[model samples]
Target chain A: AQTVTQSQPEMSVQEAETVTLSCTYDTSESDYYLFWYKQPPSRQMILVIRQEAYKQQNATENRFSVNFQKAAKSFSLKISDSQLGDAAMYFCASGANSKLTFGKGITLSVRP
Target chain B: NAGVTQTPKFRILKIGQSMTLQCTQDMNHNYMYWYRQDPGMGLKLIYYSVGAGITDKGEVPNGYNVSRSTTEDFPLRLELAAPSQTSVYFCASSQWTSGGPAYNEQFFGPGTRLTVL
Candidate 1:
């Protein structure tokens, strides 16, 4: 069984600043996928970024990027130039065989 | 495209009551999943179907049942509602391929909020 852990329950970032949400997982599979999902008040889950465990390079999408350290079993999400719209609950998930295990989630607050 | 659609955006049921939550996907996806989200807790997989006729239990499958009679529809049934079942349920679908990009990503529905009293 795989488990994802997000140590931070709440995080706040000033507008235009950067914020990083920490995530760690326990999995023995070498070939897997890590993902970060955002859920706003609308309760719609949206994909933020994804990283393949085999890839040494981190994954970056617009202002969202992941610091994936496979050896350390750590995958953290970094949100740059944070805006008010970035206020949401962020989830870290890992998947293999189409099944995903998610962390408890971190509530992000972008303050202006 | 409607993507993934879940009916009855909100519902409240008393103890021992039974209800079915309907889910439909227009993407013609072969894989569908049901998950429940609790406050401060991440989403937990309740059930999943690889195809129309195959269904499997997930981490939290107790008190819930699912059927996938058609490719587009995967409905979850609660035979006897309980307060512990109160949570937001999400329906998701993804195209399955032995090795492909779409296999890793899942499209999710708006979610249905259910309350059991």
Candidate 2:
């Protein structure tokens, strides 16, 4: 069984600041993938970033990046230069054997 | 590319009623999935298909049924809609090439909101 955990229920960040959302996962598979997805008010799920377990280098997409510590089973997302549009629900997921287990998610609010 | 699309942006069903949620992908992905998101919760997979005519149950597959007749379509059916079934459903697709750059990164649909009374 695979399980992802996001401990914080909500987080607030000021404009132009940076925020890091923590996520931890447990999986038996040696080879797998990690992902961060964003769901806005429009109910659209968008992919934020992804990391492959085989790769030692972390994944970064523009202002979004992930700190993936494979040995510790921790994958946290960092959002740099946060804007008001960053406010949404972020979910972390672990994928293996064609299935993904997601965390409960954390709500992010941006202050201007 | 239309990516992934789901029909019926919003729907309301009475208890005991049945409905099918339609999903389609034009990216020619080999893997497709169905997931439901409840209030203040993460998305849970209900079903998935690796290719045409190959369907499998996911984490939460009790009340939902799914079929993948073609490479482009995967439909989920609810036999008996209940209050617990009220949630937003998402359809996603991904390519599964071993050691591919975009492997396992799923592309999602806009999601369909369903409420059962």
Candidate 3:
């Protein structure tokens, strides 16, 4: 079974600063997809970014990007120039064959 | 597009009560899934359907039942609600492809919050 772990339960960053949320996974499959999802207080889940296991280059979407290390089984999300709106619960997920395994998630707080 | 819609955004039920949570997707996606998120916990897959008429168990499938009679609708049924089942439920759908991008990028609906007393 595939499992995802996010060690940090809570994270805080000042506005305009950068923050990184750590994630790690255990999967026997060689090929899979890793993702970061954001859920604000409105309770809507939105995709932040995604990284393919085979890709060496990290995935970036605006201020959101991932440091995906396949060998270490680590996938961390980096939020740059964090804004107040960036405060939310972030989840790391791994997917294959329509099944998605998610980490416990990290609650991010941005202080202005 | 309405994307994926889950009805009854919030629901409260007494123990042993039964209810059905309705989910519909307008994207014409061939894959649908049901997941529950506990407080401070990650979402856990309850059930998934590749397409209409095909449903399968996920990591945590106990106390949950689902039916996919039509491509657009996948309803989850709870025969007897329990306190442990109190959590936020999300419905998601994605396009089906042999492999790669389409299969992994799932669009999620605004979750339904349920509380069992």
Higher-ranked by lDDT: 1 or 2:
1
In candidate 2, position A58 carries an lDDT of 96
Superior candidate under DockQ, 1 versus 2: 1
TM-score of each model's chain B: 0.95, 0.95, 0.96
Checking candidate 2 for backbone clashes, the offending pairs are none
- Considering just the first chain, candidate 3 attains a TM-score of 0.98
Docking class of 3: medium
Which candidate would rank higher by DockQ, 2 or 3?
3
Model 3 bad stretches (over 4 Å) = B99-102
Task: Give per-residue CA lDDT, model 3, range A7-84, as digits (tens).
Answer: 999999999999999999998777788999999999899999999888899999998888988999999999999999
Question: Could you tell me the TM-score of candidate 1?
Answer: 0.98
Location of the lowest summed lDDT over 10 successive residues in candidate 1 chain B: B95-104
TM-score of every prediction relative to native: 0.98, 0.95, 0.97
Predicted candidate 3 versus true structure: per-residue lDDT over B29-103, tens digit per residue: 999999999998989999999999999999889999999999999999998899999999999999867765523
Model 1, A23-85: lDDT tens per residue?
999986656899999999999999999998878999999999999988899999999999999
All candidates' lDDT scores?
0.94, 0.93, 0.93
What tens-digit string does per-residue lDDT give for candidate 1 at B1-117?
999999999999999999999999999999999999997889999999999999999999999999999999999999989999999999999987767652369999999999999
Chain A vs. true chain A, TM-score per model, equals 0.98, 0.98, 0.98
